[model samples]
Target: MATDSQLATWEVFIQSKPGANYIHAGSVHASDKQMALQNARDTYTRRGEGTSIWAVPTSEIAASNPDDNDMFFDPANDKMYRMPTFYVMPEGAKAI
Candidate 1:
């Protein structure tokens, strides 16, 4: 059996309402999926602030390095044509 210090870390996400996007809430440490889920709910939803909770293992998440921001995101900066700035609105057209 794994000790408390050796337990896996799970990232927690909370949904405030139905059909709303889940936002990163925090993390919890647990030995298994069920434990992780329960820990997340108990830790983050004590005030009934969340409608739903998702607990994902920390090892399963992939993230980009902050140092690579220019190389990874700079290509989109020069593509001004991708934006719809030149379209003329029709007369009496409702705002979209």
Candidate 2:
């Protein structure tokens, strides 16, 4: 039950290259998916900056509450195997 004045918010993601990750570019307000895609392109990719674009409705996104960050992320801190501190790098390995 939305009015014409109350456009839905859409989150825009842009990929710079074919194999690169899609990064959050910005957002736009539109009534439908097609409009959202066009608005996102016009608003964020004017310079041909993106190889691909994705426009997702803001209402569809689910996010963790910041207030629960400690409880949510605490388990990972105790998992030592998650970190690579014990791994010895081979000689001449530049960035591993």
Candidate 3:
């Protein structure tokens, strides 16, 4: 029921805990940024459930094209240390 100018889609992410990544809670449809924020609050934070919110326009999120990912990250393999699979934990060390 929204006109083209009035319809906006925002991807909502919520921080559920400290030192945690913002989780993709869901999306919201609203007339503008303010409304989207309020809607996100009602929908995702009704119970004080999150520590933060991020509402990025769905259209503004640029992702690596799947076909291009190979060319993009393949060079990173030259730095194997960037991956930690080989770092064994000291026998008694606990994960931070």
TM-score of 3: 0.64
User: In what order do the candidates fall by TM-score, top score first?
Assistant: 2, 1, 3
Per-residue lDDT of model 2, residues 1-96, tens digit only: 756476889999999989778999988999999999999999999998998999999989998999999999988988999998897888997656
Give me the runs in candidate 3 sitting further than 4 Å from their true place: 1-6, 67-82, 90-96
2 versus 3: better TM-score goes to: 2
**Relative to the unseen true structure, what is the C-alpha lDDT of residue 10 in candidate 3, on a scale of 0 to 100?**
91
lDDT of each: 0.91, 0.91, 0.86
Clashes found in each candidate (C-alpha, N, C closer than 3 A): 0, 0, 0
Clashes of 2: 0
Q: Per-residue alpha-carbon lDDT of model 3 for 1-96, expressed as tens digits?
A: 746675788999999978678999999988778888888989999998898888888899987898997899888979977877797778986753
- Candidate number achieving the greatest TM-score relative to the actual structure: 2
Tell me which residue pairs clash in candidate 3: none
lDDT of 1 by residue, 1-96 (tens): 756675889999999999778999989999999999899989999998899999999999998999999999998899999878789888896654
Candidate 2, poorest ten consecutive residues by summed lDDT: 1-10
- TM-score of every model? 0.74, 0.77, 0.64
Ranking by lDDT: 2, 1, 3
